[model samples]
Target: MRAPHTATTLGSAAPARDGPAQQVARFGRHVAEMCAVMCVTLILTGLAVTAAAAALGTSNPITGAPAATAAVATLALAASMTAWMRYRAMDWRPTLEMAGSTIAAGAVMLTGYAAGVVPADALVGGTCGLACVAMVAVMLFRFRLYASHAHHAPSGH
Candidate 1:
């Protein structure tokens, strides 16, 4: 009968193992990073909307509601993303995709405002703000899905 190995070493003499605490810590760190990214992206989105509205010269612009909405959305996105990244699990692909989409969306809003197409009402502002929020939400869910995977596999010696 083969003896059950206890200290399984991959390449070195050290035994390969990990405790729940370590896993929790790693998850926490990843969550924090995701949240930070979401927050920053949200802030940028709001700024972009404001700048775009200013270019359009709309006094109502949804009564400037989107400006505030963007601010709150960013925060919510950050928190949600963090939790999702930690508990749901996802991959980096979603994050990259979101980054690209965010840039494109911002550009579109800016162009619309510059071209005098978007009105300064809640319609445009709200739409853009909502879009940004949606993007962040997607990012959060995607990352969460990836983060759930066990990353540090025991290096088999």
Candidate 2:
């Protein structure tokens, strides 16, 4: 007679290992953490700008703009980081596209600052933008490093 099955079956088994699903869940958690950190960073930056503006006088339009711009930039930066993390975990092509776009935008922004079009109080906003661009660059480099290491592994497994 056939023996009864004692081990877990297909539907009853746990995940084979931390595969794509675990990677995705990890990415989601990372995104949430990044967002929270960005929120605090932006808020502090805005408050600093506002205080500096008040000291410099409300007549300064640049000071006021930075507070608002910083908030938006921070949120965008968080989103970009999340995308980069996800891409790093699975793919590189789309990440390249995003990194290219981000770098181009960052260049344009830095140009504006170099032209003296940006106000002194809004310098913080420019700094935040640059940081976001840098984050993308770091992510790209990290993926490249890991990919090379993975390819050279002795066995596919």
Candidate 3:
């Protein structure tokens, strides 16, 4: 007698994995996390600029020039984001990777400013804008790190 068919259907069957909906949900969660981290970084960078302006008693140019402001803001952005990530108990590698990428982007812009290639208005736009873009680029390059559910988990949970 012929054997009845079963759900197993063993030969050449595809391995079960997350459905499309589940994949989209996970990606959405990661995007939210990135947004939260970046928002915090930008807010902190603004506070840093405000504090510098207040201390200097002038807003014409923070730290005496646009280039200086760019450098300061870029560092602040990197530091703020790194601090927040570490607070969340994220892995050190990615944290440092992000910080390094931000600093590098700022350095490029600063160089451009020095060379007179970057306009003063662009610097005023905030160096963190470029640094933030770099951070997102790094995230995309390291997709596996950001895509995995474990990376998004809250610490001590």
Candidate 4:
């Protein structure tokens, strides 16, 4: 009275039987995409900060821009983090935690910038860089887990 086991019923392990080469290629594509996202996020954050500083008429744009630049970079980084999580099909817990931490850090940096304790460029650049690095680290960790799973999974055939 039970249904027979089929490829579809076997879940992901069914498709993964294709072998390691396919798995590596899939991971490679993910790595490439992650790199591209990071690059674009950094570039866009820099441009946004520069434009914000210019628009605000900061005398020494690099060091004189308002905390707004940091805020903008934080927004961009949050978006990137969300995208990375979605692409990896990860749970939202880490994404939420990362977003919270990023926002908190950004707030601290903005406060420091406002208090003249840190340069605007440092605040914006450091926050953006840190966020991107964290994202890449998360992606790498996920990939390692995936690879390990694939390695241990039983061959469907």
Q: Which stretches of candidate 1 lie over 4 Å from their true place?
A: 1-15, 59-62, 65-157
Ranking by TM-score: 3, 4, 2, 1
lDDT of each: 0.50, 0.50, 0.69, 0.61
* Reference-based TM-score, model 2: 0.40
Question: Each candidate: RMSD to true structure?
Answer: 11.2, 11.7, 8.9, 8.3
User: Where in model 3 is the C-alpha error above 4 Å?
Assistant: 1-16, 19-21, 62-64, 124-126, 152-157
For each candidate, give its TM-score against the true structure.
0.39, 0.40, 0.71, 0.54
Model 4 Cα lDDT, one tens digit per residue, 1-157:
2232223334455532436786567667655765576568868777766776678776555566546666776877677866775555544665565566567667777777778887755887776666656655655666654333322222222
Clashing pairs in 4: none
Error of 1 at 114 (Å): 28
In the range 71-147, model 1's lDDT, one tens digit per residue, is 44434454554344334333344534554454455455545655767554533444446455656565456543323
Find the 10 residues in a row with the least total lDDT in model 2.
148-157
Model 4: residues with Cα > 4 Å off, grouped in runs = 1-36, 48-64, 132-157
Model 2: per-residue Cα lDDT at residue 136: 45
Model 3 per-residue lDDT tens digits across residues 1-157: 2232223335747544555676557656765676677677667776777777779786656445778777777777678777877765567777888889888988998888889898877874556677767877887787655654454333332
Clashing pairs in 3: none
| Backbone Cα, N, C clashes tallied per candidate | 19, 0, 0, 0
Mark the 10 consecutive residues where model 3 has the least summed lDDT.
1-10
Model 2 misses residue 35 by how many Å? 2.5
Ranking by lDDT: 3, 4, 1, 2
Once fitted onto the true fold, the runs of candidate 2 whose alpha carbons sit more than 4 angstroms away are 1-16, 59-108, 113-157
